[model samples]
Target chain A: MANDSDGIDIDYVANLARIALTDQEKERFSGQLGDVLKYIEKLNTVDVSGVEPTAHAFPLENVWREDAAEPGFPVETALKNAPAVRRNMIAVPKVVE
Target chain B: MSDPLYYRTASALSRELEAKKISSLELVRAVIERTRAVDGTVGAFISFDEDDALARARASDARREGGEALGPLDGIPVGIKDILAVEGQPLTCASRMLGDFVSPYDATAIGKLKAAGAIPWGRLNMDEFAMGSSTENSSVKTTANPWNTDCIPGGSSGGSAACVAAGEAPLTLGSDTGGSIRQPAALCGVVGMKPTYGLVSRYGLVAFASSLDQVGPFAHTVEDAAILLQAVAGYDRRDSTSYKTDIPDYRAALQENRGPWKLGIPSEYFGEGLDPEVEKAVRAAIDFYRKEGCEIVEVSLPHTEYAVGVYYIIATAEASSNLARYDGIRYTHRSSEATDAIDLYFRSRAEGFGEEVKRRVILGTYVLSSGYYDAYYLKAQKVRTLIRGDFLKAYNQVDALLTPTTPAPAFRKGEKTDDPLRMYLSDIYTIGANLAGIPGISIPCGFSGDGLPIGLQILGRPYQEADLFAIARRFEEAHDYHAKHPGL
Candidate 1:
């Protein structure tokens, strides 16, 4: 598992997170990453027999509520906190080039 | 009158309010004054509206005068964690990115609080997006533990916990993604409950990791916590994930009809990483419970040690997807000098989020990404099943599981800030409850030699919060853990 690095570059992680890390922070995090990975690897040793995987920590069955639409916050009031809005919708920089 | 009104529990203040001994407006004024006095020292609040709180308090008093029925939490001033949206209030998750962002609407929990006549005192500080275990990760400022000014209050809900611990507010609402509520409650020496997931509505709570996040209350006493839970819990149509079940009267459950409960003592919870001092205090608390006729049985939750690994993978993977909305365009912070729109999305988020937040986002992305999905995220979910089964197997023999809320009591500020993995391990014992979607509460059990608080966590079966509260109340009655307050 230690050698199964599919180009998991530290820079790639930093870039994805959008944080510019110092060389030292990167080195330190890399070592910490190894420790975390090693710890998680221990989970591979557990045996499961006839275990039904659960998504939530509680037993939740069909959670359908009445479909009646209730009064909601006015759109104008909702958009009041938006940093960028245009024509009643939240505006963002156009993603596609 | 010299005593701080903010420190008084909701249960205590409600009786006064009901009897008209102290008007709700007077309580609001007292809280506002106290908040102003200590906010600078503790960094408990982000935004406070004294006028608004007073207005609500006046209305509450008017209702009382008119002989109108009041809710369980009527006239109580409560702190809302920054992550929970309160209508027209700045809902910054203590992050720079959302500094200017105000909520257009209230979160379901806040809405419930308002309906019950609880006044919104203000927004409290938190780990940005509820990320860190220390409130230090808040982009704005650090919230000091009221117990010791130099020490951390414990995080994500640090500000909420500190306010309640320090008497800023008797009751505050905090969300637990992974021990955010319980760990902080333990560190600050207060009662915090993470109800069975889906028990509380999550609508309008800015999602961190949808599956793991559940809003709960932090209060001065177990009864107050139960009452607050009663106010905010139940099925909500607005939140699809909310459980569709009748809300039980938690206050009634705490009235003590049941007794001599069976408590499970899992050995893994007491092993290696536990501090000797914490173990000693917790052991004493257990002995007190045993004297109260509660049977303590040693049990094994074999998958318990694997909780931390499974939690990070599942929580981070969900976080990565949930936080994708913050691309610098729609919400709070936007970056300049975007060569184009795509660059704006990348650069804005890059600049807006902090180091720990970024690390988790990256780790989340990697786990959820194509190549590693099966090995990491999928495997974690499967392991999550095993973890839940372990709890179920133990519950079949015992009523509730007892463990130390945190491996150790609160540490000094910046003690483990540099070491991320070590910091993550702090939530080890508490994380499994969240992953398994069960209810857990952290109540002050005892104090360490240096006088820091020690917390005992009580974990119960799904939707069995009433039983959990019953056991906790028995323990509280036997030992005066709730009576010990910080010197602040």
Candidate 2:
């Protein structure tokens, strides 16, 4: 289920991504992403030892705001764009029997 | 003949509105007419509410008539890239996932624009989820380069740039993640700036790569861009990452901070793959500054070659995580064919996302997948550190770094769509600034042999946008490139 070609297992990765790719899309993406991965291997040439990872350009500590409740979106506004609304709540398919 | 009202810069329009020579309603009508006349070919707008725009314009006119105008941006109509939430406006990221979705609230940037008396006019198009370098990835429509309708307006801020270039709007807001704003602005021959990472709050901007994403402006001139930037910049509690520095008056700084400053030209950016015309124009610009008593120094970014590679890995990895919220449950397109919850996640994303978005998500998922994190994602982050270090080291010696915004001018539609690698390389020159988390501005430097516009990019230190704008304004004052508009 993994590492079929180009170091990316299409089925395994697609499953992880929660995407159901068509066969044609899988083929096209596999070849294209393979080229990108090959290009990305250039990162291997850099000596990154002792270099710190930069998650953001600037550093900041934990940002804390006053723990007070403020008015939020009303129920109708919150559900305005919901695909399925039931009794002012988003309704999803049944997950458990 | 005089230029049309739609083609005038916002600064000039502001003075006209103050003198009662033109009403905001008149200007809005002229812009609406221009959009109707040319957007058929440009495809810059996804949707615009004419009555809403007119009503806002009338309110602005009333404020002016009462001598209670807000500021420079009052009565000005700025186009909004669809990536930012404009309350009640369609918040499509040019993706089918949110095709019918309406914004529940205004983005912090939009709130500031409203407070400044600026009307957020229309929803501009972009690459789906702000993923591609070209607007061709937009599921709604491909925004053509207004300079030559056959070519792409470089994206994911293509519509923001195109509308200004097409004279449909005097100003626009665009999010830059890995050169989304600057690259398109380069292609379309307008002034676009990406402020320092935390300069403008990103509260309502749909996340692409959170670390790299920033909100900035597209306008006809550096002065106008400064005006627009002034309106939306400042700290907000909602966006904790936003900087808390004192906000400078960018427009006033343009005139006050004149300098024969030292500018750096990175040698790595001048090598192979750069179109000779772009290089020639950029070199000429360097020579222009040199003749104006500014010193030009050659610097090395060293890791420039790895930028595209580093960007793709990091940006897609973040995008994959940020976009996971679209699971057909809340405000996104739900699959009609789903039988179960998991099936809904799979089928809805499969059907809703465009081709490029799907490719990036799968690739991102693979890199962050178990056993591959250290090899791909972690390594990319380390390399990102080196890239940022390179810019910081260069800044220690020079006021700013100058380079070509893109390798070449705009390419014909469908040229690079087949090869994702080729398309990724289009942002090579502009990606470094984003990775470094610094401010970058793209101004029209020259035109290609084919009549396409070329951009000269200026990269400045983090939170030093005023100095950058001042430097850009100096170059702009000596050239008429910014004043030139595309003939539609």
- Which candidate number would show the highest DockQ if scored against the true structure? 2
Candidate 2 has an lDDT of: 0.93
Off by over 4 Å in 2: A1-5
DockQ of each: 0.51, 0.68
Backbone clash pairs for candidate 1 read: A18-B350, A57-B436, A57-B437, A58-B437
Query: Which digits, one per residue and each the tens of the lDDT, describe model 2 over residues B1-488?
Result: 17789989888998998888999999999999999999999999999999989999999999998999998888999999999999989999999999999999999999999999999989999999998888999999999999999999999899999999999999999999989999999999999999999999999999989999999999999999999999999999899798898999888888899888999999999999999999999999999999989999999999999999889888999999999999999999999999999999999999899999999999888888898888888988999999999999999999999999999999999999999999999999989888899999999999999999999999998889999999988989999998888888
Question: Candidate 1 chain B, which ten residues in sequence have the lowest lDDT sum?
Answer: B1-10
TM-score of 1: 0.94
The parts of candidate 1 lying over 4 Å away from their true place are A1-7, A11-29, A48-52, A59-75, A86-97, B1-4
Query: What TM-score would every model get versus the actual structure?
Result: 0.94, 0.99
